[model samples]
Structures are given as structure tokens and as C-alpha cells.
Target: MKLYVNNNLLLDNITIAESLKIRLVGLLNKKSLNENEGLLLKNCSLIHCFFMKFTIEAVYLSKDMKVLYKETVKPWRIGKLVKNCTHVLELPEGMTTGIGIGDNIILEGEKNGKGQ
Candidate 1:
């Protein structure tokens, strides 16, 4: 999938982590994330970087996909719990330079012609 902010492309090939196991192991052992890669954690409000090897940009979104807050978190640190956040987009650090609070997010999937 592709992630966009107000129609501006932010990243591509995004992964959605919704299961308890997937969400818990989010980016923990990964040494780094590519510029076009990101993980969207569902039903999350708080995030931490404990034991993380690289810094990351966390964009919290409301249930309606509105941006609630953004944070550039360093390794081994914890981020503030944002209110009304139902999803968290975790990207590589420095990838969220132009994103702003209250921006709308758009997710588009690949064009798979499976005869829908």
C-alpha cells in the first residue's frame, strides 16, 4: 500500500500490523527501515523505542485517519501517549519532514486485477 498526506505521497509499500504478535514485535530487531517502507500499527496510542537500533518517525492518527500528533523518537526512548489516536504510522526518521498536524491520510493499495 501507499501512504499519502493530503494527496502528497509520503511512502510506499506500507505494512499493516494489527495482530497482537505483529504489533508487539514492531521494528524491534530491525536495524533500519527503507525510505519507502513504513509500518502502520492499528489500534495504538502509545509507542516506545526501547531496544530499537534506529530512530523513527511516529505519526499518530485518529479513528477517522486525521493526524493527531507526530514524533521523532530516538532509540531506547518512549513517546507520549496521544489522545484519540487509533492508528500509528511508523516510518524511518526524517521521512515526515513536511507532514503537519491535522493532515488527512490516504492509503491506496496495489492495482491487482483479480476480476473483482
Candidate 2:
């Protein structure tokens, strides 16, 4: 799977972390994220960077896929809790320059978050 913006923004391959086990181990076991890779956590609002080896960009999105909040978190840090967010996109650090609040994001090959 992949994450996109404005139909073509970013175009990064992503792993859908919907299950509790996947979400809990998100990015923790990985040493680094490629420039074109990411993680999308379904039904998530907050995140932590404890034991992480690198920084990352976190984008909180609503169920409709609208950007609700964004932040840059470093290793061993806790991200701010965002309200009204149903998904959280994790990307390589500093990769969120083009995204902004209210912007609509899309997941490749999915509609309303249901895998196609």
C-alpha cells in the first residue's frame, strides 16, 4: 500500500498498521524509513517514539482523511495527542512540508479506508 496527497503528493509506499500488534510494534523494530516509505496507523490519535533510532514526521488525519494535525518527533519522545483523528501517517522526518491542515489525503487502492 501507499500514501498519497492531492492525488500524487508524496507517493510513498506504506504498511497499513491496523491490528493491535502491528500498531504496537510500529517503526520500533525498524532502524530507518526510506525516503519513499511510511506507516499508516488506523484508528490512532497519539504516538510515542520511545526506543526509536531516528526522527519521523507524524500526520494525524480524520476518518474522512483530512489532515487534523502534524508534528515532527525525535527519538525517545512522545508525540502530542491530536483530537478527532482516526488515522496517523508516519513518514521519514521532514517529509510533510507540502501537507497542511484540512488537506485531504488518500491511501492507494482504498475507499473510505476499506481495502479494495
Candidate 3:
């Protein structure tokens, strides 16, 4: 369940803890998240239900894959911009630090040859 950008490993199957109530309303494999493309959720929202062992670097996105919010969320922290968010991209912890909001993400990498 690792999130990747081309050959670059963004988040390696990081745990999505219960701290966030994330309802996977719509899902696509690697093809869904595009390089330089944005994610837009049409009919669903992601919820964070707080619990234990929740490991994720949450990257909040708008309908056009524009970065709306970001946080290196663990077990107890709250996810920002829960509302009005069209998509949530979870990267590895520290993968998105200092990356300003409203900016587009450029997914870069090659196929690392590692299989889940």
C-alpha cells in the first residue's frame, strides 16, 4: 500500500490509523493519483477517527490536486481542512514539510521494483 511518484516512493504502505475517520468513498489504484494532476472527490469525504498506531503524513488537496493543507499526523493530532476538502493524499512523514499550501505537487520517481 505504498504511495509512489513514478519510481519515487512517497509513502511506503504507511498505516492509516483510526485517529482519522477516512471513508474511502472513491478509490483508484496508482492510476488515480496523477503526476502534476489533481485529485477531486465528487461524492464523498474523508474522516479521521482517532485511535492507536495511526501513522500517516496527511496532505490535504482540493478538487484539482492543489495542496490545501498538510500535517505529519500521528495518533492524537487533528487533520486540518477536514471540510471543503475534495481529496487527501497521505505521504510519508516529513515528505511534505515546508511545502506550501495552494501549490501543485510534482510526483517524481522511477519504478523501484519493490512489490507490495
Cα RMSD to the true fold for all candidates: 4.3, 3.3, 9.4
- Candidate closest to the true structure, highest TM-score: 1
Candidate 1 lDDT over residue span 1-116, tens digit each = 89899999888778888778778888996899999998888888899999999999999999999998998999989987998999999999998887889999988996321222
The C-alpha TM-scores of every prediction are 0.91, 0.90, 0.48
Pairwise lDDT winner, candidates 2 and 3: 2
For each candidate in the order shown, give its overall lDDT on alpha carbons: 0.87, 0.85, 0.46
Model 3, residue 97: C-alpha shift (Å): 2.2
C-alpha lDDT (0 to 100) for residue 50 of candidate 2: 96
CA lDDT, candidate 1, residue 74: 96
| Better candidate number, 1 or 3, judged by lDDT | 1
lDDT of 3 at 89: 66
Runs in model 2 lying further than 4 Å from the true structure: 110-116
RMSD of 2: 3.3
After superposition, the stretches of candidate 1 with alpha carbons farther than 4 Å from their true spots are: 110-116
Q: Model 1, residue 53: what's the lDDT?
A: 94
